[model samples]
Target: MKKSQDDAKSLQERALRLLARREYSYAELMQRLSRFASKDVVEEVLDHLSEAGYQSDQRFAEVWIRNRLQQYQGEQRIRYELRQKGIARERVDQEILAANPNWPELAAALYRRKYGEMLAPSREEQAKRMRSLLNAGFSYDQVREALKHLDSEAEFD
Candidate 1:
């Protein structure tokens, strides 16, 4: 019917407006569009947009990874976030592998930016630093390497 056609058109318009603002994963767009229309309508509109190359999970994943890296987030955090956004595990792994960031160096850089040079940090201070790095999604090995490298630098200074 005309009403259904209008609904699809409006949904497509809304989707384009959103895409104009930023890249959205298909899952994200679905969540957003579902609020306004039925699941079938939203899916159809999204499928059309996807076919038109206006929506892409792969592009969304790539852009998301790049932005997170600029914020100095680690691979684990990026992977978790991408998954939360409905990106598949294989896609997440592939994008992360494509990124190929240096984990230890990134951790060390983040640490240096945050805590600075600590000539004689106490055990408590060390623990705090380790916790911060871990929470930032750095692996144990990466966190240890970061602290060890910084501690040695501080000792020499």
Candidate 2:
């Protein structure tokens, strides 16, 4: 019993130190703490942090989404990344919708930045640019809207 108590305290301290540096989702905290303690102990520590309002998956998701958006990443990539971090699909969708970004416009700006104000003269060139945007996590609609004005010099703005 004493051993378990000491382990819990140690895990708590380690968790606190990590949280001090940055917010962590419950899943992330558990993965980190599980390396040093049992699953039960890690869960208990995480529960304690949750109760104390030290760790929050929602907050982590929000911050992570914001950071990724600032990096001009697409919604698909952001959703995938949040899911990989153990955030729920519902929560990911909720946060993304709340951000209210203009996907088509963002896609246009990204394409313009990468390929410049030049139009793809050949079918092969157009296909290559389309492939690049699609691979960058843009939806078909967004990609289409982005390339719709490929000949317009002021399309990027």
Candidate 3:
């Protein structure tokens, strides 16, 4: 009984230390703690931390979204990353809506930052640019809008 209590205390301490550095989703915390203890023990500690309001999936999601936006990542990429972190789809959607990102503007801005004002490139060059944007998680329409914006800007220059 004493050993069990000590183990739980150690686990809680480890969890608190991790939480102190940055927000972690419950699942992330579980995964990290599982390496140190059994699933039941990890769950118990996580539950306690959560009850104490030291761990929050909502806060984790919000911070993650904000950081991703600062990196100029698109919505699809952010959603996929949050899902991989075990955030529920409903919560992901709610946080995304709360963030209220302007997807088209962001896409255009990302394109401008990456490619600059050199317009009317070769067909191959255009395809390469499209691929880069698509891989960055922009959808077809969003990529097209960005390219269109680029073309218009080039015309003005």
How does each model score on TM-score?
A: 0.93, 0.88, 0.93
- By TM-score, rank the candidates, best first: 1, 3, 2
Candidate 2 residue-wise lDDT, 1-157, digit = tens? 9999999999999999999998787888888889999999899989988998998888898899888767667888888889988888998898888888888777777787888877677999989988887777788988888777555546655
Q: Give the clashing pairs for model 3.
A: none
For model 1, residues 48-82, the per-residue Cα lDDT tens digits are: 99999999999999999999877778878989999
Instruction: At residue 93, give the lDDT of candidate 1.
Output: 94
Candidate 3's residue-wise lDDT over 20-136, tens digit each? 999999999999989888899899999999999999999999999999988788889999999999999999999999999977778778777887767546999888888887877
In terms of lDDT, model 2 sits at 0.85
lDDT of each: 0.89, 0.85, 0.89
Per-residue lDDT for 104 in model 3? 70
Separate clash counts for every candidate: 0, 0, 0
RMSD of each: 1.5, 2.2, 1.4
What lDDT is reached at residue 59 by model 3? 95
